[model samples]
Target: MTPSIMSLFMNSAFLAMEAQQVVWLRMMRVAAGGASADRELSRMATEKMQAAIQLGTAATLAAVGGNSSERIAANAIRGYRSRVRANRRRLTK
Candidate 1:
């Protein structure tokens, strides 16, 4: 499959996993109870949410097949190699 399509699939999977984790955390917080417990749970949930967002962004980038610089560099290298090969062939003839 194309890189773009593959990226979309990976991003979707990552998001699904994140959703499950959020649900699990919410359930745990509800089970804990009490004002103090609620405060702690809120803190923990906020931290987890931040981390999940960071990770999700990374996953999205990976799914998107990363930055264009790498692809551009590779294409440049391929073109240069092809040119060199053609020059060598001409010199030989």
Candidate 2:
């Protein structure tokens, strides 16, 4: 594989790990009774909606611009990565 592809794969792998960490952190918080069921469900729903919007927008732009599939995937991944990073920071504190 090319260096760029390798880099993308590596970054994606790291992102996946971060995403898992965020999930585990949230689970821990809930298990510890730190968050109410209603609030947690609402927050999760809102986050999923935002992610869907972002992915849709990215895909639309890529299609209109005749960009490659990899670019679309990269853009989608970027949106998730940012959300995951923010969640990690918030959960840690």
Candidate 3:
């Protein structure tokens, strides 16, 4: 990949982490008498869960495939999933 693309991917990964943090914070707010946050948190969590399932499935397909389409789709999903794996590697300051 080009350096520019790599940098963009890095930025996107950080953005995704921020989005996840926001979702968690919203959940906390909902717990602390912020009922309005519930709908948003629920929506965000549902979307994230669906995405995670798709990524996990694609990763699994990449792990075990007999034909070509599965492998191709897996590779494409893996590219997207790399950002997710990056988000998991949080830094402590």
Candidate 4:
């Protein structure tokens, strides 16, 4: 594979790991009584739904516009990565 392809894979892998960390941290906060469990769970679920919608919309637009496969994948990944990064920042606080 080309270096750019490898880099994309690596970046996606790293993002996945960070997202998992965010999930665990959020859960820990609720378990430790730092946040109300019901509210936190509801918020998390809502965020996931929003992210899914954003990702689907981006990917669909790219695909319909006749962009390359890579572009479509990038659009989806970009939206997801942005959300994951934001969650990571917020949860780390």
Candidate 5:
């Protein structure tokens, strides 16, 4: 065969191989989507629960009256703030 004809054939063969590879990659992505989706849902649920707990803690702090118990509530709020900072660092990393 002429060099030009052989080069064209080789290029066509490479294109077909690439197309097949792309199809397989898409199929694999679809197959793995189920587990990844489940993991994402679980992550979202955990974050929501954490937010709820933080809100509840804030509500407890607000519920304290203007008495001696205020000191204890203030301490709890400080602890909650520390926990929030730690969680932020953990999540950001």
Candidate 6:
């Protein structure tokens, strides 16, 4: 069950990466028109990459069982919940 859950998370992460990449590529097309646009796109891409890395790391930690699997899974769940809440807040705003 844990492995299956981890796989689902991993797949979702990959989808997020693909979506981010598509957005970044589209941004790059517009970025070519101005220096400021280029800079902003670069910053956005960097932020997205950092978020992907953080999510991937958390998933990896949760997958590798040890004395801390329970703790890691709990932390991952908390992170997921926080993200959901943040998205809801953004949508409401």
Best by lDDT: 2
TM per candidate comes to 0.34, 0.83, 0.38, 0.84, 0.32, 0.37
Give the runs in model 2 whose Cα sits over 4 Å from its true position. Answer: 1-3, 34-37
TM-score-superior candidate, 2 or 6 = 2
lDDT of 2 by residue, 1-93 (tens): 123666678779989999899889888877777446457667878998988987898799877999777777677777889988998998788
The parts of candidate 1 lying over 4 Å away from their true place are: 1-3, 36-93
- Please give, for residues 51-80, the per-residue lDDT of candidate 5 as tens digits: 668756765665664334444444444444
Looking at candidate 4, the ten consecutive residues that score lowest on lDDT are: 1-10
Compare candidates 1 and 3 on lDDT and give the better one: 3
Candidate number of the best TM-score: 4
lDDT tens per residue, model 4, 31-53 = 97744767778889999998888
Q: Report the lDDT tens digits of candidate 6 across residue range 1-93.
A: 243566657655755665555565556555566865676567657755776788669778667745256556556655654554443343234
How would you encode candidate 3's per-residue C-alpha lDDT over 11-84 as one tens digit per residue?
65666676576546655666766655666567657757877787777767755765354444435445555644
| CA lDDT scores, all candidates in order | 0.51, 0.80, 0.56, 0.78, 0.52, 0.58
Task: Name the lDDT value of residue 92 in candidate 5.
Answer: 38
In model 3, the runs with Cα more than 4 Å from the true position are: 1-36, 66-93
Q: List clashing residue pairs in candidate 3.
A: none
- Candidate 3 vs candidate 6: the lDDT winner is 6
Candidate 4 vs candidate 6, lDDT winner: 4
TM-score of 6: 0.37
Backbone atom clashes (below 3 Å) for every candidate: 1, 0, 0, 0, 0, 0
Which parts of model 4 have CA positions greater than 4 angstroms off? Answer: 1-3
Checking candidate 5 for backbone clashes, the offending pairs are none
Compare candidates 3 and 4 on TM-score and give the better one.
Answer: 4
lDDT of candidate 6 vs native?
A: 0.58
